[model samples]
Target: MRLARTLRFDQSDENVFERAAQPDEWAVSGAFEFSNWSEDDLSGKRRQAFANGWLGLESFGRATFVATAKIEEQEYRALVERLAAHFVEAWGAPDLETARPVAEKELAFMAGLCDEHEPNTLLIVERSLVTSGVSESFRAIAPQEATLDLVAVHVTSDD
Candidate 1:
């Protein structure tokens, strides 16, 4: 029998999120930086993406490195579109051949840590981009309380 990972959230602490960000093995290439609260950014908006309570993927540049946090599917794709737009303006269309799978692998890594899949869950990627590239609407949601969003983040860098 296939046992689904428990996808419960700790109302007060980020430990649950921290554990969720990690899997037995990582699929993406690069060194994984696992921390209680690792720092990360999306474009110009910096946040505690790696902390026990955060969500989404912080992809810095193309094939550079990737960090992750949990996110909703809709929110996730929206961020990717933002990145795609950024890449299109800068270089003219993104080379998905290199982008899509990388994001998927990281997404799956986090998913595996969950007890069960939630419909609202997402696979968002926050590439290191200029804040302007991201729509103001995305930033409108201030005060990201951990309880409201069951997510976590992890950073990665090559030695």
Candidate 2:
């Protein structure tokens, strides 16, 4: 199976998100967090997050970029448990048993988003408040063949 993991090119996420997700943590669209929000509620970092954040499963934080990655079944199961627990604590789910299916569906949707892309392909989600509720759209950036090294470092010495 495949899912998205947070990627950090810089420290901007730390500045923009309430909590910045650590690089490589699992991520989902996480629009669920704003289920009850109104236009008046969209301001500041919350606005930034609503515009373009991927929710990290581990930290429950936000990330601006996420890359597709392979996931083992065991790890997927573990994520389900963690997310279900979160639903209980964060959303007041009746119990773990009731939250389990909801968590599974959330993860499954994330996995489906990765199904058509290759590993390391970056995915972005843009969300906007529609009349009924929030609407999400995804864009994918596939990795390209590099003609030269994408990064380089210079060393200086004084003698």
Candidate 3:
């Protein structure tokens, strides 16, 4: 889902880097592509950002880090519409080709996924972000405002 969010950096602390790398409140509210990968990467998306930490699933051999930006709400609907079109034009969501008004359909698809994975928004971060040396590289120049397009699939208990 596309929602407005802000991740302010508190550079005052000695552990600012540590704080930036860790997931914030918005991370729990929705899944985010923290990386710069295309939304199509979501079909194979398996990693997510959470309040406590991250989650990953290796489904059908598709997974990657795709960071998400927190954006303003005014542009949210347009972005979703653009995303729907992006999938159809760039990624080729064949089924969406037939779904008149692709944006609404995309919204439903995302909403359904969100329903199943609420209270834990996904985040796409490179292994380097959460892994060793995270403190030095994860720092943000300023607070961000963007939407999160979550595509990571949560594995079942059996899986």
Per-model TM-score on C-alpha atoms = 0.25, 0.92, 0.26
Q: Model 2, range 18-92, lDDT digits (tens) per residue?
A: 999999999888998988889998999999999999999999999999999999999999999999999999999
Q: Could you arrange the candidates by lDDT from highest to lowest?
A: 2, 3, 1
Please estimate how well model 1 matches the true structure, expressed as its whole-model Cα lDDT: 0.31
Instruction: List where candidate 1 sits over 4 angstroms from the true fold.
Output: 1-47, 56-94, 116-159
Q: Which ten residues in a row have the lowest lDDT in candidate 2?
A: 147-156
Query: Candidate 1 at 12: error in angstroms?
Result: 11
The clash count for each model shown is 16, 0, 18
**What C-alpha lDDT, on a 0 to 100 scale, does residue 67 get in candidate 2?**
97
lDDT of 1 at 154: 48
Once superposed on the true structure, which residue ranges of model 2 sit more than 4 Å away at CA? Answer: 147-159
To one decimal, what is the Cα RMSD in angstroms of model 2 from the true structure?
Answer: 2.5
Q: List the candidates ranked by TM-score, beginning with the highest.
A: 2, 3, 1
Candidate 3 regions exceeding 4 Å error are 1-75, 91-100, 121-159
Total colliding residue pairs, candidate 3: 18
